[model samples]
Target: MDSVYTDVGQARKAVEQHLARACAWVDMGGVLLVVSELVTNAQRHARGQWQLRVQAERHRVRVEVSDSVPLPPRWRPGKLDGSGGWGLRIAEQCADTLEVLTSARGKTMRAQWLHPGRTGVAVA
Candidate 1:
């Protein structure tokens, strides 16, 4: 599934719908949290629209969030007062693998999670 959203709330809702229909066996909370962080970062840092693509298979799910900014997100230490700086860390912990690809026009954050007992290798 592919969608573009200018609003954070809408992006979140789209993820929820995709999860329900395509990835019911995956961890809902983890996917939601990762989506929220990436989408929120796109809005807050890129200050423009963002696109979300979700690919669900029998043994894995991949989420990609693209934005107009070429810079990748930074990882900062968590704050005690909850002022800021924990999104990337949390997302990394939840996803099996996370990658960032950047170009002159934009960047894409790709996160993937494998179903339990599924190894991180292609079966072809």
Candidate 2:
């Protein structure tokens, strides 16, 4: 599923709906966390339209968030006062593999979670 959203809440809702139809293979909570973090980052930093693409299979689900900012996301030390800077770390921990691709126009943050027994293997 692919969707474009200018609002963070809308992006979260769209991802929730897409995951509802996927098979019970991947960890939904982890995926949702990753999606939320990525989308929230785009909204807070990119400050414009963003696109979300979700691909689910029997053993894995890949979530990609594309925004109009060419700058890649950075990790800053977490603060005790919750003054920001933890989303990337949380997303990385929740996903099996997290990658960032940058272009002149924008960047895409891709997070994928593999089923417990299917790590590093392709699903047939």
Candidate 3:
């Protein structure tokens, strides 16, 4: 699924729905959270409307968030230990593979999570 939304809140809801239908509801929430952070970062830093794409492969669930800014994302210290603000770090922990690519049009952040059956077994 691919979508472009100017509103971050709407984009978040759309991502949640897409993931929920693609996977388990609870698992979707986690994916949605990561998607939300990516989208939020794009909106806050990028100059134009962001784009999102999600794909379900046999081996993994993939998400890509693209923004107009070419600069890469950075990890910064969070305000409080449990008070959020660590989106990139959290995404790195949740996603099996995460990448940031640069292009003339914009930058894209890609993240993927391995499917349990295809990956042999889920890590504890």
Candidate 4:
């Protein structure tokens, strides 16, 4: 599935609806949430439209979001007061592999989570 979100709010709903159909109900929530965060980040920080793709493969499910900026995501420690910058941190913990690829056209953030049989294990 592929979607184009112009803003953060749209991306959230798009992720949830799309992931729910692509992944199992039990794992849909986590995958959707992670995809939402990634898409939201791109929508907020990047210039043009953001693209999202969710696919279910043999042993895992993959979510990829592309933006109009070549810069990769930043993973800085959160502030004490009330600021939050922990999206990438949470995604790293949840996903088996989280990759950020940058090019002149844009940057793509891809997150992969394993299926039940794989138990989130990486294949070598």
* Top-TM-score candidate index: 2
Task: Put down candidate 4 lDDT per residue, 1-124, tens digits, no spaces.
Answer: 2334145566657666665666653366677678767866765677546887777766777888887788887788977675768778877777878999899988889988777677757653
TM-scores for the candidates: 0.85, 0.86, 0.77, 0.76
User: What's the candidate order when arranged by decreasing TM-score?
Assistant: 2, 1, 3, 4
- Candidate 4 lDDT at 71 equals 82
lDDT value for candidate 2? 0.81
Where is model 1 more than 4 Å wrong at Cα? Answer: 1-6
Cα RMSD to the true fold for all candidates: 2.5, 2.5, 4.3, 3.1
Tell me the lDDT of model 3 at 55.
Answer: 79
Name the weakest run of 10 consecutive residues (lDDT summed) in model 4.
1-10
Measured by TM-score, how close is model 1 to the native structure?
A: 0.85
Distance from true location, Cα of 82 in model 4, Å = 3.5
Pull out the clashing pairs in model 4.
none
lDDT of 2 by residue, 3-120 (tens): 3424566666777777778857677788888888888888788875678888887778889999889999878998989788999999999998899999999999999888788787
Residue-pair clashes per candidate: 0, 0, 0, 0
**TM-score (C-alpha) between model 2 and the true structure:** 0.86
lDDT of 2 at 52: 85
How well does candidate 1 score on lDDT at residue 107? 96
Superposition TM-score, candidate 4 onto the true structure: 0.76
**Model 3 Cα lDDT, one tens digit per residue, 1-124:** 2335246577667767766667652357667777888877776767546888877655678889987778787768777756556888878877877899998878999988887666674432
What's the residue-level lDDT of 70 in candidate 1?
A: 92
Clashing residue pairs, candidate 1?
none
